[model samples]
Target: IADQDEHCKKFMEALIPEAFRKLQCSHPIDHWAGWL
Candidate 1:
């Protein structure tokens, strides 16, 4: 369970940035509005 958790954490660390960048590029105004 701990190992799975660690792997998930690493995966999320890598995925979140790319996902966020895509979201930002695809919807800049909406993303910023929701983020803010």
Candidate 2:
């Protein structure tokens, strides 16, 4: 449904950034700008 799609979109918007930050912190190497 449209509501589910909206919810998934928001959830991903929320999670992806934090996850990417954690990933960058965990691995401090080349291409770290992906976190920002």
Question: Which stretches in model 2 have alpha-carbon errors above 4 Å?
Answer: 29-36
Residue by residue across 1-36, what tens digits does model 1's lDDT show?
999999999999999999999887889787778988
lDDT for 29 in candidate 1 is 81
* CA-lDDT, candidates in order: 0.92, 0.88
Clashing pairs in 2: none
Write one digit per residue (lDDT tens) for candidate 2, span 1-36. 999999999999999999999987778754565766
Q: What is the C-alpha RMSD of each candidate to the true structure, in Å?
A: 5.9, 6.8
Top-lDDT structure, candidate number: 1
Best by TM-score: 2
Error of 2 at 7 (Å): 0.3
Q: Which residue pairs come into collision in candidate 1?
A: none
